[model samples]
Target: MDDITEINTKENRQLLYKYLIKMYGKEKAKELMFKHKDNLFGNNSLAYSLGKRSIVFYCLYFLQDYFVPKDDNTVRDLAPVHYDIWRELEDIFIHHTHDKQQFILPRGCAKTSIIDMALSCWLHCYRESIYTVVLANRELDAINFVEQTKIALQTPYIKNTFGELVQPRKRTVNKLELELDNDTKIQAYSSGSSVRGTSYTSSKGKNRVTCFIADDYISEADILSDESKEKKYIKWQKEVEEAGDDPVYRNGKLIKSGTKFIVLGTPLAKGDFIDSIKNDPEYKVFHKSVVPFDPDEYFENHTYWQKFKEIFFDNKRENPLQDAKEYYEANKEYMAFETIWEKYSHFELAKKYFNKKLVFMQELMCDVDNVGDSWFKSNRTMPMKEIENHTFIKTMLTIDTAGVKNKDAKRSDYFAFVVGSLADNDFKYVRQAHLRKFKEFDEYIKHVISLLKENEDITHVYIEKNTYNGLDVDAIKSEMVKHSELMKRDITFINEMQRKNKDDKISTIVDAVNNGRIIFCEERVEQSFLDQVMSFAGQRFSLHDDAADCLSEFANRIDEIEIMKNITTIPRGWLF
Candidate 1:
């Protein structure tokens, strides 16, 4: 449906029935409006600007005729999806001490258009904020936010209601700052930059920044590691956040109200910036995922939806929804999961990243971690106590080095090691130990030797020589000489040239687990190792594969795995 632009419509439909009833009596008007609702619109008026009760109505009314430039900048109406959130936010902003609030919404949920520009206008229009500050990741973003606010002030409805917020002669609209005629200053700055001078001396008195808005302050590209995330966290906390104090003024014996702090962004990962705010008890958060309910729960047939989706997006067809019109009318409930916006339903949006489950989960669902089918059955693995009585014929260790040339690099991948032994004639492999860490040459070899010494039955060791060009293995071999006095003599160290595809090789571990041949010692296994093995799906599917790859390497050599338990064992490390 075309956007309901005429405020007459927003104003009319709300009271059209009452007006019609006054003219044609209650029964007739009710019959016409209910049975033929499409023909009716609300009663026309600008009465929503009266008071706090009109907060929701006023914002929803202003959603149309936005002058802000966001592609095809024409009058657009707020979708039904916007009402609930806006109502809730308007209530909080108008009548509560929302000291720190967050709106962690999905990527294209119109958060900026609604909250940053429109809701901000609401605050300024109502004189809720004295000095408002917008903080962003980049200088351009900061400028853009402030620019949009200025543009909103220029809109017809805004001007008619608020009456020229900016002063004509004053430095009203600069690149990053605007001083309204009401002595209200709204400015923008890049996050982490110095905001020590945000305090302004207005004619009335001293003006401390009473509002802080962090909007898209942290993007996906900003978060690389926990350390990088912490850097941003510190900047946000120190500069952008601390710039605004609670009270705008202090009387001799009384106090004023506090700042209304707001944050808006989608979370990138489990321990990212948004999650940090969520964990803090002081901040109030409202999170809205793109898909409200699991689409597959209601719509079980993928092939059917794929057909309708294909037809809809073909564009070549005269009508996109024509082919599946009946089907959609019947099954739209599956897609109607109370999305934040009705323009894109759950099924409609899912097609954008249908194959990329991890991306879909992170971006659309706000899921810190994606949960899906794993290659191995994590529940089937036996604990350490269950396998204590088993006799071991051969033991070995496999290493998956997080490829790095510099051992001393501050940020490098971990070296993951897996130690497992084959028991008697049964194909079962019992894990003895697992370790993963960022270690230098000496420390790495020390752990390797400890794994060897801890599990004395280990007769063979294999380490994938990735990027290190066998240098890591060679370093360990050279370092083993130092520990030769403490180590047993028969252990053989082999530099494994990892020419095979890791994704293909990991299948062996899955097969071993499915056959009940691979067992995990819960007490001895490292948590990271367990996480890797359980979460790994294959190729680019998981974040880390160190521990899983080490076990997969062990499975690769399973066929000829043998080590002379008493003698130079024949059934030792197996050959793949």
Candidate 2:
């Protein structure tokens, strides 16, 4: 026997058991090393047996040899996130439960390597008498997945470890199918292919498709065009859903219950096929973005960050590449704390990093509104250079409260408020805005009072009466009375009750923004406000429209406020 085989013998196993007992307690060590004795030490060596337990460990040790050589002849390290996802999928597959899973990772996060290669190898080696179907947007992609799986299976590590268990009956890349010795099969099919009518059958007369994995079902090009998106959605509903639900038969007899469907893709658009499945109650969505740290906290706390962002945008307009380099070099202190800068400090990291602002927000942060079809363009909104220079005729505050009073409710809408000053030219400059799910009514009241106290010029406060029977408005007024000593100044509270539909509210805000009537104060404004405005896609489609709704409430009243100002300014004789 070989040296490795000799080490895995009965004598060596007993010696290792004694060593493990010394290290860990006898019961703990026995549970760890000898729980699956037959599977671990029956035919395969200890290295193969232990490695096979974890997909991440197996890939790192065994599959590293099979990785396609880089330009420098070095293999890339698998990211930590990949390991996390592999373990999650491993648990699901082992339980044999019909559960739907979705992974929303960024591009180049190795969704293909982890799913098509590592997971496939693990499944083929461990699980037997099961069939898996791989689907993609195009036939070529599906074929590629199968090709990669075959390569992974052919690797010396996999061949040596599970040699007898999963011998290949048929392996053809072009055919997009593989048959194993244990009567298990894997097939690849395109999204629009004829998969609904077809059934995968094993040598044991089992004709059940156990697992279905759909990867990159929606392409970037498909998301941009409306017609293509519609067509893809139709194709997904008809073909993809049908194939996932198709019955599994054995020897002309119905055998399996249901297939476990796993959908993996980056969120390229809002209402894509992946998104459709995400909304479905059957699927459990595990959406993860590449955000290294929370940008919201920084943007909210740092006064100069918003101004810095405005400068970055201005510089990007002229030359995105050169300007980013210059900005990074000039503001090294400011950029040093950012996660992107910590990893990629150089300018030539990639051309895409030059457009870091959009890439970071869209790709890493997974800001669906910024990446997909947005109603309001983020670039169109200009920042104020000097708030002091602008002359204000009237200043107003608009508040939109979530109807629910429960502090612990997870799905409760945010309490959003916008403070703006209407200039002499009727152009309303947004001084500041706040949007947050308040924990209590006291907290919400405190924030509102703070905003009013900070901006002494705020003459009118309009609270949208969309809550339970004007109780929220009455509560606010009652709270304001308690803080009258602190308020020190008279502030008129207006209960605006004429509720406009979501479409009208969005349209009103869009018109004001596009027509150059609503200007945002860059220094004082919150990033959440911009995100809400940019992501607002009318009432039905948006994730959160509270911020936009608050802004629109102010916009709708701008004309009325202007007219009231004009009437007050007119002479008494002229009025007579």
Best TM-score goes to which candidate?
Answer: 1
Q: What is the TM-score of each candidate against the true structure?
A: 0.55, 0.52
Kindly report which residue pairs in candidate 2 clash with one another.
none
The residue-by-residue lDDT of candidate 2 on 402-446, one tens digit each, is 844665566668888889887765467788888777666677777
Query: Which residue runs does candidate 2 get wrong by more than 4 Å?
Result: 1-42, 45-53, 66-73, 164-175, 220-238, 244-257, 292-320, 326-362, 369-576
Candidate 1 residue lDDT tens string, 300-410? 456666666555443235454555565666776654446656556555565443323455556777776532357665323566766666777677888877643556554
lDDT of each: 0.65, 0.64
TM-score of 2: 0.52
